[model samples]
Target: MYKYDQYDQALVDARVDEFRDQVARRLAGEITEDQFKPLRLMNGLYLQLHAYMLRVAIPYGTLSSPQLRMLAHISRKYDRDYAHFTTRQNIQYNWIKLEQAPDLMADLASVEMHAIQTSGNCIRNISSDQFAGAAADEVADPRPYAELLRQWSSFHPEFSFLPRKFKIAVTASDTDRAAIQLHDIGLQLVRKDGQLGFRVLVGGGMGRTPMIGHWVREFIPVSQYLTYCEAILRVYNRYGRRDNIYKARIKILVHELGAEEFTRQVEAEFAAMSDLGLDAPQAEVDRIAAQFADPEYDAGAPDTLDRSDPDFAVWVDQNVHAHKHAGYAIATISLKPPRGIPGDASSAQMDLIADLAERYSFGELRVTHSQNLVLAHVRKADLYALWQALAEADLATPNLDLVTDIIACPGLDYCTLANARSIPVAQKIAARFESDLARQRDIGELKIKVSGCINACGHHHAGHIGILGVDRKGEESYQLSLGGSGAEDASLAKILGPGFNKAGVVDAVEKIIERYRSVRSGPDERFLDTYRRLGDAPFKEAVYG
Candidate 1:
């Protein structure tokens, strides 16, 4: 819920003007496609399979109702009647016309949102826990720091052209909901004694080479946070591989230079940088933090939060989460229905979400990295009523962190690089496991991620059951992976031998789950825990042999 200041407003407006001119030139044939590619990418515009796709940044996955409504209007008016929420918590319009992109950017600026840094090999959108401010167990809200980094990295001249894309995520909660370990730089907000700081993790990434970040700094005081971050980036910028894009990420840099050596280099850079005293200005930090102050609450007598409605109770049990503020909760609007596309929200649905955010929640909505929409900071008392409204809009599917609530990327259907379709595969899986609540609760803690290619856009490597789609001899095939997780205990999934044809992938998943069920010590053991205990041998044997 951070509002844009004059500086932020000026920056976006300038970018819009810049892109407007670039787009006009491209349309006028003043620039060739080759000459225009980087310019378009820097502005977050993509030439996709059928049309241009414009990705808009929802910084740290947070949005205001006005912002959400603006997006809905954009989708309905300019392009298709729906938008796809990406795994990074950004939203994409797939059918945008090349000429209209600049207009769209201007429209986004009207609502204080823009597509800058949503694409390109620069620091992408700075994501934090979608539940940051609201999560009950958080030590501090991570958004302030995330926003601070966002402003710092926005157009940092030196980092604009890094060897590869850089991603940074911060989380304040005990549970790693932001998938911090899977990011190039993960900062865990921590408090020790009376001082607040960050526990920094470096080198984590997921693409062809997936890695869980290594802890580099145990505690970096808030005052020194940005200084240290600069050192890390400086080190990567100087030495990170550029000859090969695949080896260009900071993760690969950290791997090639041992963590100890990498840490030493960063420390040396930090020591030198500190002498110049270029840490983020405290005034800037305080200024951003002020924008995110906790909303004033009544502190009055408890209001009645009725759950008498059976449907409402079901939703509360499944979709609601504890909030840091008293008498408030975070409500996740599930995108996974019995047969619905996992993260596709139609224009009408987007409008409904925007309205709900304005009315029930605090005029703030958050898109989760898990591809679900969240109306954070809803008053507990209005939970039932909100559920009723969401249910009517087909947004009240109560399957959070469950098997049916799968994560998928736009595959062969929309993405030019994809080998197979991801949405349909996700749909088929959801239908196959169509939520017998008891059965799913019994199965427990399964994270299935499916991606169209080895690019790992859907983060298949982080799934408890990862499926990677590939084209084999002119046919679509899927490769299954086991034991992956994206939580505090993050691990790269292990592949289960030969890839299976489209029809065989589902059966293969069933076989893996059955093997887990058979080997599990008790019903209490989740698939991940059991998989860890027994290793991939059992699941591999079941699927491959």
Candidate 2:
């Protein structure tokens, strides 16, 4: 993990002091709710239906053990005893007091963390693959570049207030685990003729208008990445819609202008900025890269797991992922235990995770976009011990990409914008399929995402089975979609048919799954693959008929 320097510390300290003053003014009635909206948003504070909510950024989803412990401390002292990890790889505290927010911010700053850019219409947290440095198939670790962008875009005067919020993601592997195609700006690291470069994509987003990004440049040399990115942002800031909040995202601008003209404008801007010295220096890149050097490993550790215990074998199959090093594996800690709320980690659980990370993963952990945590560099020889510890803490659920590992938003339970509750739906579905391990394994690689609204915070648009909650005639109804994916084969899901009531939605999902089982070519064929092969007609008939 990258440590904060004097400059980084100073910047965060200043922001905390500024927000403390702002909070005091708002509480003292010196500023009205209307006047304090933007000020509070800039500090990552939101006035939800019940109480104030605070979102804290976990940059690129990486955290040190001390940082994790601090999060536990905040959860215990300030809000409720649990925190919600989000699809964006950030964490949210739902029950917050306005007067105590400054104290929370101060504690976060003490651990080199903050809530800046988490809620504002600015460049949000820069995200990357959870297994960035340790994955076996990666061409390069994308975190150094993500950190570079984080520093570059933080409070940049030019992009401080865009028409809408912007998100950027980076990935280096052929498999797009970061969901790059659904971001405002997606950067894929590539190698051409043994020289490293980037494949840039722009305008992709989900909200109301779902889109897979348009390819802007096939290749931009590593040296000129910053310049090219600046060009793209400059164009969007100048021409993106300002009249309607619904049409303000860069995706709308790209849709109206078409990819060809957008590419041309971006090229023109790049040409003009190329000679202005915006390119990042090689020395700076090397300096950042050095900060992420690999940890020391045992030279002669075994590569295989001990399958003596069937339970440990099940966990190993589900949670352990292949690593770049022979003796290492990436261990995913599931937040979804049987019927537990997805991504809700209690304060004690957070402390236990921190201790496990320190013991097994060099005091570091990464948060996954699927709302799980990763000990990205765990040694294979220590798998049994780690699994035992995680089991005792209720963090060892042997379901990674299965139907039970659901992605769900706070929904009506916490979010005022939501129409229905998502957590209960997720819990019901998980419990409905809890006992059938063999059946779930047979289902194979299914991702079910639930969102309470069209804001798509749960990333329902990218799930194999996407569920969206809507208000239909004063009753809570759920809409179902199929064939969505967030991997390298990124695509938005298609709606099935008429909406289902709360009681009926789960049955509809079961019907769809049964239809998939009946129609799939083999047990190995996933729900998304079967749907893609057969189209929506079969699934739609099963659900609506």
Give the winner by lDDT: 2
Error of 2 at 315 (Å): 1.3
Best-fitting candidate, measured by TM-score?
A: 2
Per-residue accuracy of model 2 over 1-545 as CA lDDT, tens digit each: 88887988999999999999988898899999999999999989999989999999999999999999999999999989999999999999999999999999999999999999998879999999999999999888889888989988989999999999999999999999899999999999989999888999998989878999988898998888988999999999999999999999999999999999999999999999889987667887888888899989777878877889999998889888999999899999999998799999999999999999999999999999999999999889999999999999889999999999999999999999999889899998888887898888888889999999999898889989999999998888999988899899999999888888888999999999999999999988888889999999998889887
Candidate 2 has a TM-score of: 0.99
lDDT of 1 by residue, 108-223 (tens): 99999999988888999999899888888999988999998998899999999999989999999779999999999999999999799999999998988999999999999988
**TM-scores of the candidates in the order shown:** 0.97, 0.99
- What's the C-alpha lDDT at position 132 in model 1? 81
lDDT of 2 at 286: 87
RMSD of 1: 1.4
Query: Residue 103 lDDT in model 1?
Result: 86
Every candidate's lDDT = 0.88, 0.92
